[model samples]
Target chain A: MTTRAKQFISADQLLEHWQGHRNLTRRVIEVFPDKELFEFSVQGMRPFSTMVVELISIAGPALKGIVEQQITEFSEEVFQPKTKEEILARWDAETEVINHYFNQISEEKFQETFNLFGQYEFPVYQNILYFIDNEIHHRAQAYTYLRSLGIVPPFFWERF
Target chain B: MTTRAKQFISADQLLEHWQGHRNLTRRVIEVFPDKELFEFSVQGMRPFSTMVVELISIAGPALKGIVEQQITEFSEEVFQPKTKEEILARWDAETEVINHYFNQISEEKFQETFNLFGQYEFPVYQNILYFIDNEIHHRAQAYTYLRSLGIVPPFFWERF
Candidate 1:
């Protein structure tokens, strides 16, 4: 007789986890002093604003693309918001879109492979996790920038 | 008539995504110069070694605890590996354990909430994502430390 293994988490929990990261990232954006968000970099890496643009371009649209099965070309257009409030608005807007598109995905479709942004083909869940991973990666950079500027970032665990 | 949404990934795909982050993090650990891993810090935050210990302590045992329905107390024991090689070994060991225990999870259990490590009561999947999130957070710190030390971290997209 063979016993079955239990699942680790549900789709809803995955969405919650993704949102938690997004929430923390939004807070990180809020804490950045205006000039530093666009000016600070370590060893000539891109500024935090550019990183935010990359994130903004990817999160909502990528999920929508996956949901729609649309193989869209990767565009290089980065939204240049003039202020922190503008960035936050864009971020919040994208967050809503992410929720809307994410719920459109049912459990079984997660196993199907899709070419994300007309680029790499992987399981849809992998693509979504990439969104979360990329966000955390950039947020870490922002955190370092904050510490360098003598400002403390929000504690890592405060994801609510 | 109701329209149904498609799921874009499976539990297996989510595990793959989590493993990719782990793989990249392992590469980050390997690339660090011996002394810098433990000695470097920004604004007096904990060193990268301590961060790795936090990751090691949380991942394998956390999954095991979740799978076995055991609520273990969080331990503050940071492994003081004398060498980078030692750190890599511990990391590899934990990685193997993660794979072994992760496979033990079934799809249904993901929807059930578990108090991970006797704290942070959430669905098991959220807890696992927390593992990935925490890793990315610290790895980014290590990236900053590497840049500050005039070393380059592995490319963020090279998680394979």
Candidate 2:
């Protein structure tokens, strides 16, 4: 049933949308105090810095794998950035890689399915969406952590 | 510089990606206790139910406006659903409307710019992304509310 729906967004727009969310998530990361980003968590969830590492590992590398059609094993070298600035720098580098790899994805490739990171067989578009959805999910956790620390996150509407 | 990037996803994939997020958000809403859904807030933000209403107001109607080329004024008559069941019903109805209007959008229509809800002029694709992004933003707030109340949110990957 879901297969019959028509395409509504172009590949460029999808990139834009993904980038907008990334931008906002970056801002959310910025709002975190240095210690809390690496050390804080509610219940048993990982800290915001840990979550950022997961995102950093997925986004740029996943796009490269998808575009290159190389279904490599998912092995994230855990990045433990002690400072928020270091984390932000890693985030920026990943952002650049995402942009570079994303541009290599032609419109036709979006329809082709690939086993992303040697798992999760879905079309390229869905894979990209997973990258986005995953970021939103973790960032939500970070938002909770921020609020708990009596910090206000950057406004959601400011994506640029 | 960003404008020259090629599109990566078709319209249908975008819709699927969006619906997945919406599905997860619905589950998030369901997880909320009845009174707390409407009453709870962290750092003076509006309750989750209120955020849901704002979403309900925008999505279906925005799609209708975009497809029909009717740039109507944005006037959200606040819906105060008394029960979780009522909220779910409204959500389901809006989901249906979103499907219906989303199908009305043609490939060409997505490229044309429309002043969404009489504000924020962008192409239809960006506007649709806005809807998804806004929902994610609010749902994150809801997640924080849920965790703070000792309720675990639905797993982020289980969007299907």
Candidate 3:
């Protein structure tokens, strides 16, 4: 028979999803040529490169704050000019940090609620969703940017 | 013949992931008992309900702003205390709005970037990630809440 139905979630699985989603985001960045990454814009919006910088920023100190119960200590990352390669490099770095932190979570910690920026309170799982949801929100913008360029970014439907 | 193997990316696949991911976050709220939804917290945090309100406020207003290309005037969707049911209703509403706006994206519009909060220059794709990332971040906190209650959430592996 299949393994027991594990209704209880695992930090590993959450981390996996985190990794995969980041993969998708990075690929989307890759699909865009260097010119498109920095120059293209829909409605005079921020460039893709700027968006990637913001992405790099979410996990490093942000996750730490939620875990330790303090504000992120730095400004919410704002996008600025950066090379595509630089964006990708930071993406990889942030992924590593997030994975390392998530791996540290034990089952007991899952149910505990914590302060997110001294504002909202939620369980660790809910916080995980916040991270993912926020990324998807931003990714949606990327999808729009990709399509507007007539270069289809990867699919939004694949969960696996 | 199929095109080059570019990360095996598919927009449809990403959406599937997005939908599943969203459902995961929405479901966590349902699993949470009403009492804990409002008052519980770990290490002096707010409440799970508080985070949900923040979500409803951010996702809807952010999307509205992006699609309409003007800073949105938001209501107290995320401010003040909200019942679990109210949060659920808002969740449903945001989903509908996001899907509807996404449908309007055309190939030509991908290149047009909309200003996000007048703070940073981000491509449309980056903006979308903002939403996803925000959600996941919060969801992680929920996981902690569920675990602290000795309640195991759905297997995180299934999140994708």
Q: What's the TM-score of chain B for every model shown?
A: 0.92, 0.93, 0.80
Q: Which candidate is the best by lDDT?
A: 1
Write down the RMSD of candidate 3 (Cα, Å).
17.9
Ranking by lDDT: 1, 2, 3
TM-score of 2: 0.89
Please give the clash total of every predicted structure, in order.
14, 11, 116
Q: lDDT by residue for model 1 over A51-97, one digit each (tens)? A: 99999998887888888889887664857787989999999998899
DockQ winner? 2
TM-scores of all candidate predictions against the true structure = 0.89, 0.89, 0.47
Q: Write the per-residue lDDT of candidate 2 for residues B26-109, one digit (tens) a residue.
A: 999998999999899877578888889899989998998988888997766867788889999999888889989997788678
**Which CAPRI quality tier does the interface of model 2 achieve?**
acceptable
Cα shift from native, residue A8, model 3 (Å): 32
Which should have the higher DockQ, number 1 or number 2? 2
True contacts kept of each: 0.59, 0.62, 0.04
Q: Which ten residues in a row have the lowest lDDT in candidate 3 chain A?
A: A1-10
Candidate 1: stretches off by over 4 Å: A1-8, A76-78, B1-9
Ranking the candidates on DockQ from highest down gives: 2, 1, 3
What share of the reference contacts is kept in model 1? Answer: 0.59
